[model samples]
Target: MPVLPQVLALLFVVTWGVGAALLTSVSQLSPSGYDFIIIGGGTAGSVLANRLSENPQTKVLVIEAGIRLVSHLKSIPVPDMTCNSSEDIQDVKIPFLATSLPSTSVDWNFTTTDQTGLNNRSIKLARGFVLGGSSSINFMTWNRCSNDYWDSLATASNDSIWTWPAVEYYYLRTSTLVPPSDGHNTTGQIIPEVHGQDGPVQVSLPGHATELDQRVVDSAFILGGRFTYNEDFNAGKSIGLGYVQNAIGNGTRSSAATGYLLPIVDRCNVDVIISTRVTKISGSLSASEIDTVEIAQSANGTPTKIKAKKEVLLSAGVMGTPQLLSLSGIGPKGVLSDLGIDVIVDAPAVGANLVDHPLVANYFTVNSNNTWDPILRNSTLFADVLEDWEIKRQGLFVDTPGNTQGYFKLPTYPGGVDPSTGPLSANTEVIFANGFAPFGPMSFPDSGSYMSVLAAVVSPTSRGTVIINSTDPFAAPVIDLGILSTEFDIVAMIQVIKDIQTIVATSPWEGYVTGIYGDLANATTDDELTEFIRNNAVTVNHAVGTAKIGEVVDSHLNVIGVSGLRVIDASILHTIPECHPQAIVYTVAERMAALIKHQYGI
Candidate 1:
């Protein structure tokens, strides 16, 4: 059993387990009118709930589709496994273990419509429907994008509030850095003093490192690259190779629920409802201003209406927020008409600016003497690591496999401009993952990819739109990710693939391992590389910018043309950032909560 459950079980045993259940039941039943109604109690909603309810007089209600937070096998911190394990990925569809709850039960199992690029296959999108949202299921990489990415948004939106310095304060306030222990070498660093020491989230380096990781780092340096050690990647600059700080602490995933929600669950002013889905957000027009939101609850296989006194906040993430907006007659005119819902706010931009990073994976077979082979072959090592995590909160299970990630501009993207300057080359990001595996356990190769790395092009200018197909709340949306429609995206990926090839060819592995898939190592032509990428690219699963900020909503995160409604999740990102988005979502939620408090004087 995990440490948390053991602690809870010990406490439960002391109180006979009856008091624990009774307290939980009592907290669920005790409810009153809230000043704010937050939909989707995940990453952003949890922060909003905790911060807004800080005022003793203010009431906050957070509605989630999953149950209360619990520590199980899936949620336990295991450093050896990536967040995208067979168990985690397969859990989205199965319903056997407490960890393997059905995706339809707690996750909005959404899929994109067929893409014209990449053989026209619809991709499965798994957005968490649980209380902690995607943060609960995401790889706990605590990386923030470059400052220029946010400054560009501020310039594009004509709003200075989105500037880097303005948002940096929030990022600093939310994170607490774990001080480096004895014998840890953290040199040539720019550590910031403003980082919180008593914050809810715990950010730290991995406790263990495999020798394969060291070889990959050395190889990068040998290939004419510079490596810098960073104590906090959230300090507004992420452009080097280093151990990635994660959102895990003391052998448990520090989800927003664990960091923010669990501490405030017993508060009188906070109400969290699980297994409740918000079907629609209805409003009336009074002298050109919207008034009152009519909320429908999914009860007993039917929809029931409820009213909110103040405002409705949608943190249902990139996919679900737009779906809810379209269902409530607040999207494109054509889309709303097709769904048979009358258009109230003809926000043509709603669900229009969809952006995501597409990753091209490269694999290498390592020598038997390589460090990674032992972990792959030894089941006893794996079990021992798990046991160590359970007992001592130390082992391979607590560390991210993607220990050293590089955020650098490709030589072709000098001065932040793609060599092929077109629609698809805007604000690109090249994420280099070391010692990682793209496929899961069943597909684990014998001599697996030694230092596998994926180069993800983030903040792509390629924009797609997600549309509603039916009036049914449970029906999946038509997500058309118009990937690689522009020539610039193809050029960028070709350059990235070439770059990875150069690293692999020049690395120490040249003597030990064969090339990528045998006989394909020395292909130098751009056409060959482009074709190889087209046949092998997969999504990094970092989808964002669906219901984009400033286009579909106002600066305060409110949906334009509709009062008493706002979206406070990844859907509000005006553009995709150059890194993983979990930390930003958490910051956005914290800021949103403050905005709400200031607006209502709560």
Candidate 2:
């Protein structure tokens, strides 16, 4: 059989609940207090659980808000997948369905507040409610971001460990680069020596070759200078066109659950509780540091106060971390006072400094049928690819359709300030995928094949907030994505769109590219472009800065006013890392784990 598939990037089938456990009742919990309690057993929590529990004497407990999707052997076939919403494991495992997982049971489907920058249009904010958090359902990009961003993080925290060399060491040490499945030569695709050969998480290049992959590489070569090809985007220099690397290997997703939790969760000292909500944090409210958490199976269910003998780590992610803090009376006085909850601390920064990447996609009708339109339009081809993946763990089902990631350091706009830490950090990012853009409510054209150019302002200046609307733990937080709120963010996003448009229109794509589609075509003048942008601006789910370091949490990631409580997630980022955040999030978790162990001398 041949190796490469005609279709673009694919997906892979995985054995759910391989080593991870399911929801356990509060009665099943240990009576004796645990040494540590990690809230939200998602991405960061999973890692902390694994690392913290390594000491045999230190018992660790992970309270997760969502269910761990599990299935026994001889389960229903992938083709026989009857459940679309409730028991949809494919929504999490299949990379082709990456965006489709949102609005499902596994997702905390949040809608942001109306933004004036986007002409008062509110957008969807999807957060993972299941195990491994966003890592379980994201596009699986292992973007390490820029060295400059890490140095700035160290400067912001006044800690030398976050410096480029220090952070870069962990960046390479904690995860390994897996070889592509197709046996393709990776000589120019990646720098093998720069990556960690033996690590927990496995990252890999495109498993199969496609027609669009070469065109993207050729277009980068054709359009010299800024659009030059980058052999390794993960080597601290993230700017330029490069092969997209995902946290996947052996035709399976490499998430926190797969890489961190599954390996050490069954230890005698580790206790994982799923389908449990962390309601309120007690004891830590006062100067006395006897930190304990209240957990429940449901809103009406009985609550149990689980004592943390040593410390409590909050890994509730960007929205959940600050929202949880605010709910527990550890927030701004006005907010806590308004709710009649006793103010534990006057931390206005708990839900402040919210940042997100403003994303916009440009669609085009390509002249070639070599694209993956058939996979979207034809049922026969889809079935064949699905069968190929299920039977042999190969073909179009091994990855998402987007195969190329291009970053650019655009020139500063007129009267606009650059929020990026350094020149190495990308101001703009463009992703190339076959088939029509899967953004907005647009439908596929009845005739020609399509391609999407997703451009995101990686270094956005706009800031938003995350505040609890009600005291009820079930109530969704008021999230203002703050996308396109600043002129600089808008300017940067526009430049990315223009730059990608220029790339496609280059001499290499002269005949293969048909023409631009929809609003982008009509947007000619700067004012028209601005109007077009305001009407269509959205975020790419790369949120950070809420409950940021230096404000809400100290340099050590401990809560500013609270004791025995620390936030070790994306919420504690100094600023957005100017890229897809999973790599940075995992790296930070690893470092914080070591810090916690050292702090306790465990």
Candidate 3:
């Protein structure tokens, strides 16, 4: 009925009423033209928007498929300033509480194709569809990949830039390291030299870790006696028992949208259009460059074409990038033909090489009163916990829930041979959460409090694909998350479970543990464990390698057959890292920004 354009601090906000129709006119464009048109204003895209738009003359526009949640650094939602109710927006700012939020709003909620390895069961693939992307919804752990993982990428693409020495610079550039509160270096857990002081994103430890955390770390040392105590994994190596760092600051989630985009929203050259999905790139099939992008605010709304003068950067993440490329006819010939779409690049590797860590959750009941479940289970204590966080930015709410994490190599079994490759570089990641079923709603049994330890296979050999299911641009992609598909991976998982059981059964941990649950609880032998694994396998939610470097794109992240079009997100990773992929994604985006700046001499 009316058009309202409210411009404040260079931000142009456009609001629409319920059931508003798309403008009949063509999509509007700036006269000077944007130097970069970034799709999906998520983690990487948000960083690009901030870095590329630093020069006032350089114009950048970010088209996001989800809502814009941050406007200013102060306005960004924090755990303490947010809500006590899980139904409220503040729930997202709380690290552990975020996982319990419904997927209807911010998550794409895509499921995998029936995983043949796991008894033909389709697993839920919860990808963030909101601004800041998965960083906004993921567990706040900020562990980086192992040096070997980077070396593997360098070898895969035949590029030395992917090596640790080169890539670590980008990691430093993306983060503003927060040292452990107590100033001393060796005495405290965190290492200061490994961190950068001046950067955009903030990296900090949990505000309030529980006593159970220390016990877990001590237990891990007892279980894996061979590995050294690595206080900081982000420094380079990730093979030891230590406190897992998180993307948090002052008891709040420091998401990409909050850290990178919000503080610089006042830049005159940067434009962010949220709640808009880019359907396809309307460019020549034979041509090497992009012409324009087709996008719609609503699913059924009319698609509008907007020109991209310089380049179109696809930072839409692992799932979105591959799906968008295929929708634009830049994928396998057979897949394009099946969907009746014109073949643009015939890049068979576009959606192939999909890899993700397979996780098996282990639950334990605590014999002591040290568990966090009782406080969470009691209404009055829980209310006090919420109030303490909201008022003082302290208490259990400030923690990431999982206080201690251990990364270790699988021990060589007695009378058993190891993989031909020899000792692996940290294959298993064990996270010890304080309370029972922290992955789900804060629930507990009437009998006793519980703790959860998730043993996840970090370096999986199984590969799968993310292919288009239909010609409809908005349709969900078919994701075959081939987790634990190989016998090698299954064997590794079995060993990791055995290690967890051993750790739980040891001195301090053994004294605290009263019972066990899930796959291992009922199983005694390896045969029973294998069946339990097949039945309980789940993703760690670290999906990558769909459109990888050297295959779908070059070493520099340029799409193989297209110019003025680049894929610079998790999709460009040669393989899923042995740790969380968020830090790697941030580093990639930082490097991409530097490369683009150098290319344009900006």
Candidate 4:
């Protein structure tokens, strides 16, 4: 069982007097309308607020459901383990803190319906309820999709603006690249022309990567057949091994709230309110536009109506955005009717086309001294490392653990690895981390160390749904990821597992691992490997496509059949990108800002 904390102590843990003071209280807010009322002050919402509020003439009001807390710099732990407590503040300025578990107080903690594809097991889906959203809680790997994917997005929506050549500018404009540590990448890993230097978000390599990370990269080279080192994965083609670029700088997490909003909190035109959930969107059906957003708490305990003059932008993320739409009578008519809610728009695609990356891994026993598991197991070592992290932000504490990542395609496999629906993007990703398996229980040898090579199926043919459980706006939605719900995806996962085994058996990477887990290392056939995957498959937490473009929204991200509304978050992604969606989401928000500015002539 989990322990509870003192409520009073939590509420006052840190004073956000700097930025939180500028926020409006429910009672303090006047009934005055703003030019834009953005719901969910999350990853993309923070960006939207910063860019949209740049117009001195426009007033932007952002309502976030989570409260603010001062962050403490903490050391990184083994992957998938919870490190930060409710009292622990999340630093918006820190980028390496992505692997921390979903903070209970701030995380929506949604779970999927029993997956028929995966033995009827439900998976936990974590979404940040805080001001910065999942960007505040996600691993900050700075990677983008292949140009081909973005080009297809343009074609899908019948809009040239979504093309790679046009949208690529926003990708550059959103991030300021910081080169890796001088000592580690002396051979030059980053390509200068590919990144921007004056953007809001900060992107850089880990301060120092482990020897194991380098060995894994070297092993890719040892494979010698289309397995060469990629100097930079962000150059539109990421299909090889390399050091991962992160969103960390100055030894802290640089979330959208810190990068975009923290710097300009004094702007009088922008008003932010925390711990206030938007329950429903109310407007006249005849106008085909939104007029006001109803909040959980009114000034006098009744529902409060915050009006939007220009538009109501929904940056509420993949799950929350669609739930709010359904609640506000903007989703499928059948779903709304079942919940006893009148349908504003009978859009069937509103909660459909869910996508996510499903992952499974093989564990290996290594030298105790080579891996960092010992540090986490010993209290004294953990304390020392945590102290070092709090003070200097160096050593094992600063490592993003999985700072080394590899991407490859499995084209020719036993049961067909090609995506049944989408383009031929790389179907597999191997993340070499400095710990044991990212998920599941481990049976460690008495003294030997352990590390994990997580292989995730990035290009999955499986589609899921994010439907509202009931009309209750506060209830969690029914998220059915339907992972491995397709035959191609299943075969692809099995093939990737075999490929990882082959890679680890090579020179440099093989030298580190003393032994491998029996189920994979001993299995001789693909069917055995497939069965292991069926039992151990887990999500990489890369959920997207629930409310995607070309289906729910058009090129501009405006919810189809509606006016004065737009979705500017991961939910709008046509498909989950080949890489992490943080950087891509930033690009999407940037492009949306430009589009909104041009459309309304702001």
Candidate 5:
């Protein structure tokens, strides 16, 4: 045989071998059905699906509103490309789209009635509509709420099972911690023994850290406080200053759907339906039990009925979960009656107890000497960042600009146990992002506030409610955040503003920091700073407690007045966590799934 022909034959054989392996892995996934149907393949839904399907005998169906689309960008750990591109931001903005609804596709696109605390201005609320739920589109910063917040739930609900120690086990079960590597932080350190090393979801420090992150750490300590490096904030103690660990793994985004759902797609007992929007849940409501569920499909715009052999789980998140309950006639009696929805359960607490982390960004323009300045203003440089993300999966993109985070107990009432003694009545969550903008520095000025520090009031006393506007399931619900409506909430926010201003003023970067408002460069009064914050603050979109657990659902997350139907998402959080709600959602979903499996013996 000729040498050229022999070489070509060898090349063909190698290509064929690679192709065969790919086909074999892809073919392992087969369509299947389940006895229990879980709606929304998001944070909780994915965990529910994974845990429920563990039993070979039990069939599980996860109905996701969006498809499972994976790409290099989705998996990378870099932050440069994470929020820079339009596609990345759009995906992060709304992971799922409602095909049936025009203009508003994947995103619920919710808005709160004017927040009186925030200068009486309305803010946009974006919730995920995709398989992984909001876990796919969220900021990805992982921080479990403080012990006090979790302990309070136990006290309020009078359930020992809701205690911090009980929930801490689940947090450990679902997390995989990535310790800080050398040269990443000069002073910061993460304790690996306290964090989980071998878990499905990836939690690691960003590969790259800008100089600004170090300055923030030094500034936080300069503010005259103990700043300890936190390796695993998920351990349930989210205090002190440390590098923000995120849900990204191996330089790629590792959402719940990716970590939990994709790995089990081949299971014969689990069925995942994409592009399915569940409009209304119809069930037989006799006294306190629900026996059936009729879900509407967005693809064909029709409804299908399915009988629940055990229970129907609602992992539809804060927005969808409440909306589903209201549509099924399980909310306030008068509200449902007005909407012409037959009152099945008449649970008054269905859409009450709404809570969210309101964010206020304090911006400062750094000297051109700042590392991010060149890339922040140049599109070509931005393109290079994306290419680096695509090829090496290493660069600035993996770093979530807010590299360092801290939780502080702020003094609220005069002589309020002197925060030095114990946990204060209110705590402020400070997140420092390295980039100059909110979404992206170059995208839109109104969008990005330069060198932003998002200070959220972790434990606000204010509560709000969500109500249906009309009988139409597609109609957007009316949301009243009632933010800062309570005196305590206002006081907490004011303290946060003061804390942030003090950090910026006394920090090592005082010379490097220039106020967002050019004229207020020398402003020092607390009132002036508070006014600036009120005008600039926005919601972090970590909304929860709408269909609060315990109040609306039992310990197992089942609606109090309805059996077979349960809410296993952020909506069921008894109260907002002191940290981001994503990590809590993952833990709750995992625990909920175990509860369901044990209940059904499947």
Candidate 6:
């Protein structure tokens, strides 16, 4: 239901010239073509390309499956999200337009297999098929998880390198805090010391002001106990409501491509090619080596073999990583054998342990006309707001869905058997939107302005799979998110829903909130609430732990049986973090890049 993108795209076309985006690929590669070949030129791959090519002696090649938008996109901090080749001009750059990107041309358009827990329904999963991967398409909430959540990785992997301090060093080095585009003073909005001063990605608080901003913040003071105000959740203590921070600056989206890849794409030792899919990764598994990659343009296109002298980095995200490995004969023995694939490593964990947060959203009528529904319904007001963003770099367009957010621990974790790692770990998450939140299948109300409240089970114990159904690389993988499969997750969600009900009952929202809309209103008992949850919940797309550490990959992220090959990206997270996994992925890539450099004495 996002407007202004299709309208404003023409304005940008007149402002900046338009043409077909660059589409170039390597038809032939020599034995010593490059020192490293990175598959999927995405979030982690862009970071690897930037860091590895820093040394003049090293050579790097990035293979991206999506088309590049512009030749010199890095020169501008916020480039047009869509071009002649893509749809929704504001989908990537404009923060408020995050909801518009999911089913667009840049999205992967993946649908999960029918889940037994979700009332036998399949949910659509949106991952970025564009240059920057999911980082380009995700709702840009930026925050590192708790200390024990990180230390738990060290315990699981049994490696000191995964410790909190070591990860924190790279975490602080991945992004820098920046002033909001609207020039609003951030006095107590965030803790400045907790963020980095100089880094590739730019992070900032919300740029534009919202009507529900003060009320959302004041709920902590008004409610008194569980709704305490948190100065900053990124400071190793994420427990209460706080101002939302995002990966944005100057009213522009700062993704891995705009921050790392595009800036250094013209380097002498760095090369990039697009619209090319890495079909199969074949090499000697017994010798702990993987050096060759087969790539093709289409399902019927013949694949060409490309050799790598040093290593082959698998930065192909959660689903794609497991799909590639299984196609290359490194997965469960029975699954591969049934598909006529010769089993090599017998890694049963390649596509297992998938974890993602299951979220539920509700809308309520508010007393104000400032919400986006009215503007979206009116062309004049929508254009006026768009003009404000174009002229002053400040407006509703600069704000994301979360104007203020809350993170909390469950009052009574199921049976006192908590899945969270420590005190800082969060069991519930809430996103307070000033306007109608974009999730699930629901149209805006006929007449009233509304506020959308979203609640999610962050500390979910349910797991799922992402496995290859065939040997064809062009085929989509079979993904099952296994949401609400456990009693722990269901119980936590039931309590969280009640907490949201209590928070809205405060004095601040007396006239504002009318009541809950949809099927959520009819639920009163535990049985009814569970039925509504199973019929309504959808994923927030914080998926991690497919090719997890200590199982499919070692502590260093290398495929256990394959040497000179590493699986970088969200797939390596063994246990999902309570916060959004985007920040953690960046921190992991930064840390891993440093180790990869030291190993080669760079």
- Which candidate tops TM-score? 6
The lDDT per prediction is 0.62, 0.78, 0.74, 0.74, 0.64, 0.81
lDDT tens readout by residue for model 1, 240-262: 55556677665456678767877
Give lDDT: candidate 4, residue 31.
55
Which portions of model 4 show Cα errors greater than 4 Å?
A: 1-15, 18-24, 73-97, 181-183, 284-287, 297-301, 413-417, 420-424, 441-447, 518-522
TM-score of 5: 0.84
- lDDT of predicted model 5: 0.64
Estimate, for each residue in 299-358, the C-alpha lDDT of model 5 and write its tens digit.
355666665667778887787778888888889998998878888878888888888877
C-alpha RMSD for every candidate: 5.7, 4.2, 6.8, 3.8, 8.1, 3.9
**How many pairs collide in each candidate, listed in order?**
9, 7, 0, 7, 30, 1
Instruction: Give the deviation of candidate 2 from the true structure as CA RMSD.
Output: 4.2
User: TM-scores for all candidates?
Assistant: 0.84, 0.93, 0.89, 0.91, 0.84, 0.94
Could you tell me the TM-score of candidate 2? Answer: 0.93
Locate the minimum summed-lDDT window of 10 residues in model 1: 7-16
State the lDDT of candidate 3 residue by residue for 323-400, as single tens digits. 999989899999899989888789999889899988887788776676666665455555566567656767776767
**Model 6 misplaced regions, further than 4 Å:** 1-8, 11-23, 28-32, 70-90, 284-288
- Against the true structure, candidate 1 reaches a TM-score of 0.84
Local error of candidate 6 at residue 176 (angstroms): 0.9
In candidate 4, where is summed lDDT lowest over 10 consecutive residues? 1-10
The 10-residue segment of model 2 with minimum total lDDT is 74-83
lDDT of 4 by residue, 250-367 (tens): 5666678778877667887888888888898877555357777889743244677777888999988889888998998888899899889888788888878889988886788776
